[model samples]
Target: MARVPAGADLELDVQLEGVAEGVLVTASVVAPLAGDCARCLEPFTSVMQVRFQELFAPESAEPADADEQDAVESYPLDGSGQLDLEPALRDALVLELPLSPLCEDDCKGLCPECGVRLADAEPGHEHEQRGAMWAALKNYRAAGPEGSSAGEEAVPDGKAGPERTTDRTDTAPGQAGT
Candidate 1:
């Protein structure tokens, strides 16, 4: 509860049954929770009901068997034979709390590029295309087949103008004549 900044309002409906070695406690908690939406950062509130049963073993009681101890989870009673409910209540509520709360099921959230809320923005709202890493190629195409700039030479029929080779005579077997 301390970790959750907006602490929940807890209402517990509890029942206790005494056994030979321990007390069985059944609790249903109605908690009102408030937090900000994970996506759109909008504030939201909700009510969560969690029901759980746990065994509070007496301080003098030992496990009946290793398997029984391993299978069942039990909280230890205090030296005065009083059961502490805070830890149990904390566990039940915290487990049910939403990790990422949302104002609505499908929140569009904010635009990464402009930081504008997508929910409030006009439908089909978009910014002009900002060029990407290959933006120069786009501009090159926009400048026509002549070239991106007037100083540059025109490409020859969509092919490299001429074969510029070094003194090396190496060629793949099939590519020798081609």
Candidate 2:
């Protein structure tokens, strides 16, 4: 989630050259960024710098070749001969921004159970592993009444107990035993 802070001033060094087909803009940018660490969720501040070159061509120009069409994105120039640099800056900075912004290269993050920072916790800090069935039963029992212990056998709504067995075989309407 790292991004440039609002109202932050950027350092832009650009050179606009008039080429045969269009204006070739070579620029170097430095932006101030602030965000939370993706691993440990801690606030951090950083600075990013990037250098890029792009061509601003007239709106009526066509792609020279198929390879050039895919490789170069020609930013269209307006008919009045004025161009805005916002779109170019936006594209360059957005592509250069890191997807996973880390406070440190080797951040250990946090403990899964106690929610403690892993780096601050003891080396052997861990929780007892419970079985899947045991964990589910424990959660289910906890959601019920406080007095309802696992040792007790509770019946269903219409009175089903040891007498109501599910092993009954289907019999004909008139016959009893085969």
Candidate 3:
């Protein structure tokens, strides 16, 4: 047995049986690994354990039919009883990593105005002014038609432009009310 990373551990027990020309090996592994939080980008750790059954065929064995031998690996057992587990452990750690990690469910993230982490902000602190485009549109409307009231002008027939009229209500310089 090989030591897994401190974050995760691995435990494997194997039993081999001879079934005709092939050998069957059943094993299990338990381990831990570390991951980064997706939202706050903080480090987090988790544990995992998995069991698998695999069959090993002799180097001399050959399938008589065209059908493929599925889920079987052919290995020539070395003189030493030990089988290197690096590949299996690598796969286990990779599989255990989460698709997405988060330090908290609702991470406030950094404020757009000051780049301050919203998670640490003082309560009831108003966020800075952000909507400038809307203010500009309101100002445009308030300054309508060269700053004159609609009823006092004739609206220039089909021209669709502000009408200049000699009517006293419109011609009076101070009568314009926005």
Candidate 4:
């Protein structure tokens, strides 16, 4: 039916028999499914055969017991004793449909970094490693305020520069421990 999400075409080969309380409908449903593979995004098609048997109770009939009512699952027939098979067929086929259809058993899928399909990629396909962008900020902090080289004092002969202060008492205004 058109309700099938993956564009599947359904055909039902059905037989009906009258029972004591209802009509028993038996069918072999054949559906041709077409959709993309979940992992590889490749298109695929397959035939699915589902065997279904459901009891459609007459509209005037009532359950003999509460327990029987709870245990037995049956669809209701129309006032004229005609069964609408759409709901039963829809539920049966949908439940049998695959949650994630795959083109192959071992699909590698697409690369997260490059979006290239892994199956078609080279033997050692890889991207260059990128350093963190914040690393430059850390290097700048190590350099003095006047733009000295990292890890080296601004003054010559390894002496601490005027910008480099060891004394905590000489803190900048509004800073703690002044």
Q: Write the per-residue lDDT of candidate 1 for residues 120-171, one digit (tens) a residue.
A: 8999767656545358677767775555444344443234334422222335
- Candidate closest to the true structure, highest lDDT: 2
Compose the digit string of candidate 3's lDDT tens values, residues 1-178. 1223554445667677777756666666666645565655556565556665555554445454335544345444343555445554465446655577454567666666766656677874455355465677778877875655663344443244434344444658666653
- Predictions ranked by lDDT, top down? 2, 4, 1, 3
TM-score of each: 0.57, 0.59, 0.44, 0.57
Candidate 2, residue 110: CA error in Å?
Answer: 1.4
Q: Which scores better on TM-score, 1 or 3?
A: 1
Q: Record all residue pairs in model 3 with backbone atoms less than 3 Å apart, i.e. clashing.
A: 8-32, 9-30, 9-31, 9-32, 10-30, 38-101
RMSD of each: 11.5, 12.7, 9.2, 10.9
Ordering by TM-score: 2, 1, 4, 3
lDDT (Cα, tens digit) per residue for candidate 2, span 1-178: 8898888999999999999768888999999988888888887888999898899888667455768766767788778877777789889999988788887778788888878877678887777666667898888878765545432444431255544433222234325653
lDDT of 4 by residue, 1-178 (tens): 2224455457889999999868899989998766677887877776678889998886556456678777767888878756799888888988887778766668788888888888889977776444343566667665645565433443442465443464423665438644
Q: Lowest-scoring 10 consecutive residues by lDDT in candidate 3?
A: 1-10
Distance from true location, Cα of 159 in model 2, Å: 35
Error of 1 at 104 (Å): 2.4
lDDT of 4 at 149: 47
Q: What are the Cα lDDT values of the candidates? A: 0.71, 0.78, 0.55, 0.73
Q: Which residue runs of candidate 3 sit more than 4 Å off their true CA positions?
A: 1-9, 13-18, 62-76, 79-81, 101-178
TM-score of 2: 0.59
